[model samples]
Target: MDKFVTRAKKRVGGQSKKDECQRENLQKKPRSEVLKEEFQEDEEVNQFPQPVPWQKIEAEGLDCDYSLLFSKKEADTFFTQLEEEVVYFTGDQTKVQVYGKTYSVPRKQATYGDEGLMYSFSGVHLSARPWTATLEIIRDAVTKATGHTFNFVLINRYKDGHDHMGEHRDDERELDPSCPIASVSLGAARDFVFRHKDARSGQNRRQIDPVKLELAHGSLLLMNSPTNTYWYHSLPTRKKIKSPRINLTFRRIVKQRQRNAIKPS
Candidate 1:
């Protein structure tokens, strides 16, 4: 019986010493590693930001949503690829008609889409160039992210804040009523503003502040439904902003069906 008790006591003491050694080793480990192991499930879990509610502009009855479609690394990759791979044209000194008077537009722009798609705006008609590899990648990602397919993209290059676009509704005849426009911005941030068309009327004298957004890099601004019909959006000039900005507005172009009817030239 004494032999049995001695053996049991030794076993218990050995286990206690082993457990103490393990506890000391654990204490020697970095706190983060210990915590991570303790909360293994939490460490393995991925957390993402919840979608913010759509911002409604009461002045113009426009709904807008902003989302971070790309992370910083993804955005940097895109910016580098765009800068090195894509050939962007500056629409410098491009004459455009405004209120029946011709003037040069302030920035450079281009249109790219599926073959033969034509887009026109701001007294300019841009013929779609075949999509490049980089553009196709971006378009596919956008389609996947937004769950909406687009056949065309309008690329606007603002060399600096001085390269501004005027306030105008995108209610062009060719735009489909239900299609949503997703605008992706990369590089230096810029201010995008919208104002109610009614506020500009001569009879309406009340001051209405324009709703504005500071479009950030890798961010997406989605405009849909009645936004284009009720509000005019613009990128006003800011002389202090020296960095360049690239904006890609993805759009769906309704295809014009070919008719086989004979015509006289």
Candidate 2:
């Protein structure tokens, strides 16, 4: 028992020293460069990204683990900073073929990620734009707090009360399976809803209770795996709130280039 305890203590101490050294090194360099290097994946790296170790919130009757990640002050500042720094565009997503007709998405969005990380959503192929300094800061903060790594971010801007995201799942072929998706909200508060995927089955077909959350400014929400598989989420329009809202959803995409394989007979 003594030997086991001593070994555990030594391991913990070693890990602490390693973390300290890494912190010192990161302090000496620029965040952008550090992020780029991390993407490059050449040296030792931290697996978890949460900086403050945020608390996980468990609401009754909710399927996935949810947490309140940011306060008003932090969210407000980011809203202002990002509005000026990041670019938002509309009509970029390709038209989807539904019911023999093509339709476009309701909101404007921007995608930023490392090279070769392409994302296809709503029949639109979104190529990654190079990472900007502002995004790096936000990405770094998100990763540190949650101990997760993200290669790409989808930025959605709700311009008005009418602008909203309908119920949908994040189960994309290109997405890393079971990976957690981190969302950071800025600007105005909006309604985020989650519904069970079941479309009517259980004898008599009763309605599934919908889960609603107010995604406030400077807030972070994580949609963990199996959550996406079991539930569909949406950002409902709030006609009363006229101000615009920015949502940054960080995700890890499977690199197609890396997935390509050769036949070995």
Candidate 3:
């Protein structure tokens, strides 16, 4: 019996010593300090502003006629200067390859829009040039007429009937969906088609409601809500046209988060 008691006491004493050793080790460790440092580092890394909703504007009963916007002489002069300075392309400037066939885009630019505004696509970024007096005058008139604040304009010079843009949606993640897009067509009037993303049976697979507006030198087309969300629009290629058309798309860009992070040295 004595031997059994002695063995049990030794076992109990061994366990007590092990527990004391663990308690001493935990007391010596700076656990709270370590956790505090980790939390502070996380807070520092995550300190950045979140993106907010973009503003929206709508215009109703606005004049859609081309002749009401500019004179023939002014339109001619603007087109002449644009042709001289704007960069023209024959195929897709981005040159994205897909499905064993490369889709080419023929996009050109003569960017002299607003100050501090920037344009980007794929990975290409374009900074805005200071607005010229002519551009400013045009901008003000268009904004007043449409009731929208357009910050940048992308001028697409379609050289002839052969130059065209293919079927595509303009829903890039960079753009704020709430901000409306305004497109003004000058020169030749072309067909603009809008296709429904979901089509019903017995219906034409694509809706071809054509806007036959002569797009006479200064016509403005504002594309707002529901129209942009449910429809995909494009100006298809036409063979009968002889004159070139200049289409200006006014876009509102959302400020990117990464762009706001750079520290000015």
Candidate 4:
């Protein structure tokens, strides 16, 4: 026991000496100077200019509907349940590809992937699952607010501030151009930025006129005809915020196969 104690003491003493040497080296440098260097390095890396936060400046004629999209308690319960049942995939999550490169999907619960199938990040396609009772309740509320029928919904869960969806236009060939797209946000608030594709030829040239919207819990944002046609939206990352958020985009898809099959018959 004495020999063991002596060996332990010597080991502790050696570790203390190594720590002291490291502390001395660090203390020799000024903290403010080190921080300044880090700040400069960060600024150099992020060169793109960010947009201003969207604000409701004037409420003159805007028919912005403010209603309880879902009960706070119900929303909380649904999120908790979803966190458990949904299978999460990360950037390192592997999948076998049948046609092309197998891209990694984000870390979140998605019920659309095939059994033992791989997913991609670039085109993270999710099929519209059959609406649950909870989802139907919310969907009915949204339909009442927007005055439009939404046949399908694409849900996205951002587990943290780092989990982000890239900039993409939802103007796919499957969707109807005339119908409006309604998005309901729940959980943590996030910024939804929208930028124009043809800024140079149109009014805002060399300028990204982004509508940085703060999607609060149970808030609904309806994008009508012109909005989808003219702008591209993205949910950007903010390292300061650490909470999760869920966004459900309700859409009306016009099946091309159905259209083609009935034409010649």
Error of 4 at 119 (Å): 14
Q: Which candidate's TM-score is highest? A: 1
Clashes of each: 1, 14, 4, 0
In order of appearance, the predictions have TM-scores of 0.72, 0.71, 0.59, 0.59
| Native-to-model Cα distance after best TM-score fit, residue 131 in candidate 4, in Å | 1.7
Candidate 4 residue 169 C-alpha distance from true site, Å: 1.2
All models: lDDT?
A: 0.70, 0.69, 0.55, 0.55
| lDDT (tens digit, per residue) of candidate 1 on 16-94 | 7767797798789754344334333342221222342334434447887787666666666567666654555545426
lDDT of 4 by residue, 72-113 (tens): 654665566455444444443323233477644343544322
* Candidate 3 lDDT for residue 86: 53
Q: In candidate 1, where is summed lDDT lowest over 10 consecutive residues?
A: 1-10
Tens-digit lDDT track of model 3 for 52-71: 12233222211122323545
By summed lDDT, the worst window of 10 consecutive residues in model 3 runs over 1-10
**TM-score-best of 1 and 2:** 1
Flag the better candidate by lDDT, 1 or 2: 1
- Choose the strongest candidate by lDDT: 1
Please give the TM-score that candidate 3 achieves against the real structure: 0.59
User: Using alpha carbons, what is the TM-score of model 4?
Assistant: 0.59
